[model samples]
Target: MLNKVFHLTENHTTVKTECIAGVTTFMTMAYILAVNPNILSAAGMDPTAVLLATCLASFLGTMCMGMMANLPFALSAGMGLNAFFAYTVVGNMGYPWQVALLAVLVEGVIFLVLSLTNVREALFNVIPISLKQAVSVGIGVYIAFIGLQNAGVVVNNDSTLVSLVSFTDHFRTSGICALLAIIGIFLTAVLYLKHVKGSILIGILGTWILGILCQLTGLYQVDAEAGYNSLIPTFAMTDFSKLGETFGQCFRVDFDGISIVNFIVVIFSFLFVDIFDTLGTLVGVCTKADMLDKDGKFAKIKPALLADSIATSAGAILGTSTTTTFVESSAGVAVGGRTGLTAVVTAVLFLVSMLFAPIFIAIPSFATAPALVIVGFLMFTTITEIKFSEKDYVKAIPAYLCILAMPLFYSISEGISIGVISYTLLHLICGRGKEVKPLMYILTVLFILKYIFL
Candidate 1:
């Protein structure tokens, strides 16, 4: 029955191989079970509730990818998008978390409609290769920057904007946390160099263990006033009833004091990042797995996108952030996963993982920071694929601006807006206007209008 459904024999893989691949994929990406709730909790959502939402959304979405798309990829609440949801939308912009979820829901619904039509593909093709690669690199840099701050390794400075942690100022609290995080980054990097699977997850646990030792030895102190949490992890059995905190919260948006134009921008911002991020993951992972056709197109692209869009909407309704295809799915493909059975196995694991929510919710930012830094390196390495081409500098300039703007400006939408507007203007100046697609022109105008008005 498995062979009949997933064509396992035809794909040259076995049930055992697929199962192992699924386990491997889950191990690598399971850090999300810990990290996502930690991130969304900053937006004032209940961490336990976010944990349940992540588990359910991952199970349903990954299962859909298996049964509908018949691919080895898995879905989860995406890292960069969650940061945007928590930090940019809720923290910086001062929007309520409920409204942020609304924007995510709208983006997901729009994405689904586009997936069912040709618009999404058309938009995908219209963006230049350099810019697409830049988007990933930008998000990588942005995530790494966030990780540094989370680890307390980077601190605010009035004169220079940012500086390293003052080891002497908070010796027993923030200082020790920063020191452990720095050590964790080195440990994780060495593991990656040695080809260790689940290196990121291991780094988190290792750092947490080290922290516990420090706590016991009087090097690390717990002081709630100093923002230092207990290094110890509580292992209480998971409470399933906490799902009520976040469930159906997306529909509870109150827009009484919200600006209509700003709301539109928020929705578009989520849509833009998610659209390209998913497409980029699909292309890169499938290409490496040799799952693409001779024309370099993913055969299951349509269904894969549908699964991603469905996951995003489901995650929002479940009271989290946008869920999308994880780039870490490449881990499964690298381990010989080639069929939906791998994804199905992964989905079951996600469902089974919900019972461990207590531990997941306890994982501190300092512990997870190493995973973000490592995953940032994984995403940032794709920067080599951008084409500058014959000193024209037209393409590279806009891509460079986009890459720098994301981390510096602290907004992915700003990077994209600058990239689109600059790309269009540069091409027109160079007599290469014809290369700019019609939709590209439209986007350029809309982005310009956004700056002028909003």
Candidate 2:
């Protein structure tokens, strides 16, 4: 059954190798389990509950990806989307945690409906290639930003226009450590390009050892108090009867406040970001794995989309934020995860990590920072696929904008928003609007107006 489903023979990867890939992928991504709860707890949800929900949703979602999408990628509460939930929805928008969860639920249901129907595939077809590349670059920058911040390389500057680097004090230590990591990643990439086996796993382990060395030598300190604890699935007993009540109270949307304008804006924000994020992840991973169909669509995208939407809705009910497909799955793809075996491996590893959450949590973010930065560099390779030419400004400008805006705007959704808006406006002005599909035009305009004005 594994052979038939996973195509292990066709891919020339043994169960042993696939299992190793799966384990490596899990370790590389296990940071989400710790980090997501930290971010969401600050938004007022029960930290323990969020942890359980994240684990279960990640397992279920990745399992679906294995059985249905037959791709090696795994799904989880995405880094960017969760930040939006915590910071933007709960912190800035003044919504309660439960209400934010409800919004996630609504978005999930909509995603599920679209996925089960043909609309999901239709929408995937219309997205411009440039925008897809933009998402890749944006995610890269965002991941890099995460690494720098976690390493304490960048910090808030009180007097400057924005935060600046902590150049004076921690420079020598953090700089040397980060440099070692970067060198490790580069060596791994070179080996990978040369077709060396297990290069990624080796590179990651090497970088981790360097971090441990830094800690032991007093160059860095490990926070031993932040130990890991096992995650037990407990949301099965939560009184979902209050789901509606909890949601309503959290959002505080009175009938008088629910104008057509606000409702449309909220809906558009949720839909546009989720759709494009999923689309870009799918395209980027598919491109890396050579899984794109001749028509430039992922053949099994429907199930993948359904899995993502279901994961997000499940996360909401379990008390968390929007769950989406992670761009980091490209890491697995880059290392030869071409079949469901890869995803199944990833899922099994996530399930096991639940048993050792404490150990998983114990590893400092700096330890994982190397993997994040490394994956960012790997995904950044997609930029080479973009065509650069005098006549290509229409595509190039928006793409470049998206690449740059992700880190600057500090939000993948915002970067995508700007990219789509730029793409649509440019195409229209250049008399090339007919080249873009009608649905894309409509969605692009709606995203721009909703995000910008409303």
Candidate 3:
């Protein structure tokens, strides 16, 4: 039954290979188990609840992709979108957590409509190949930077804005967490080089054990006030009574006051970022896996996109941020995954992970930091294919800016905006505007309006 449905033989893969690919994919992305809550909790949502939602949503979302689209992609609460939800929507826009979630829901619904109507696939035709490559590389740097920051390898400096911590400071002041992170980096890299399956997962587990020893030997200090200091997974860590607190709160949208503009801005930001992120991941990963059809289009993209949209909407209702297809799903692809069986295995792992949510939530960012950094390096392999000749410099420049602007400006949307706007202007200035599509022109205008009105 499994062989017939997933076509294990037809894809030149076995059940064992699919399962390994799924496990590999899950290990690469399991950092989301900790990272999502760490980001979303700052916006006033319960970290435990976010952890639960993250797991459940990931399970459901990936399952949909596997069953409906027959794709190996996995979905989870996205890193950049979650940060945007917490820092921008709540902190900058001053919207409550419930309202932020409501914005996510609205964006997901819009995305769903677009996906179902096949508009999402059409929108991708206008995106330049350079920009597509740039998005992948940019997200690589962005995620790596996040890992470095979490591991205290990169620290905030008043004078420089950000600076690297000295090696001495890393071991002495940053304590056992930093120590574990450094060790995990070397260990995971070594294991990955040796072609070990689930190297990232093994690296995380090894670091977690070292952390436990640090705590037991009185070498690790627990900060109770900041809330995350436990070495074990526990359900008692968060308030479960607040599980459904953020659900169905879209009614809290206030159209009466000046808040209407802010609401629209927030929703628009969510929509733009989520759409592009999903598009980029789908294109980049599918292309890497050679899953794109002969016309260079994703197969069954409409259904795949609908699955993503449903995940995001379901995520908001589950009291978390935007859930979308993960770029890390490419980890499975790189390991020979070619069908929904990989996704099914990954989804089952997520479902099992929910039972150990406490351990996942308590995992200090440092332990998972190495996996992220390594995955970033892996994703960056696409950079070699971009054309950098004199004639192609216009495209290359925007692509380069897109890569740098992501980590430098600290937003994927900002990076994409910079690239698109630059691509539009350079083409027009160089008498190459004919190369830009009508859809590209429309996107350029929307981004401009975003700057002016939003």
C-alpha lDDT values of all predictions = 0.82, 0.70, 0.81
> Whose TM-score is greatest here?
3
Better of 1 and 3 by TM-score: 3
lDDT of 1 by residue, 1-454 (tens): 9999999999999998899778767765676887788799999988888988999999989999999999999999987899989999999989999999999999999999999997766665566766776777776787678778877999999999999999888788888888999899999899778977656657878988998899999999889676677767676777888889999988987889889888898898888778866876675566456675654455688889999999999999998899998866765775578999989989998998887655544556677677667766776776776777866589989988988887897766677778889999999999999988799999899878767865
Write model 2 residue lDDT over 1-454, tens digit each, in one string.
Answer: 7888777898777776776666667767777888887888888766666776777778888888888877787888887678878887668767656656667777888888888887878877666776776677677777767766664445567786346454445444555544555566576667677877666767666666666676557655433353312221222333224334333233453444334554445555666678877876776667656676666666788888888888877767766677788776766766667777878888877776666666666554545566667677777777887778979988999899888888887766677778878888899999998887788788787776665675
Question: What TM value does model 2 have?
Answer: 0.83
Pairs of colliding residues, candidate 1:
none
Among all candidates shown, the one with the greatest lDDT: 1
Q: Write the per-residue lDDT of candidate 3 for residues 1-454, one digit (tens) a residue.
A: 9999988888888887788878878876777887788798899887777887888889999999999988899999987789889998888867788888888999999999999887888876567878877877887787778778887878889999998776664242365676678899899899989998767767877887888888777677676665437675566444555666665665565654437777877888888888877887776677656675654666678888989999999988888899999877876776678899999999999988876666556676787687778777876787887799998999999999999998898776788888899999999999999989888888899888888976
Q: Which stretches of candidate 3 lie over 4 Å from their true place?
A: 31-47, 83-96, 170-173, 226-228, 234-242, 251-258, 293-296, 334-336
By the TM-score metric, which is better: model 1 or model 2? Answer: 2
Instruction: Rank the models by lDDT, top first.
Output: 1, 3, 2
Better of 1 and 3 by lDDT: 1
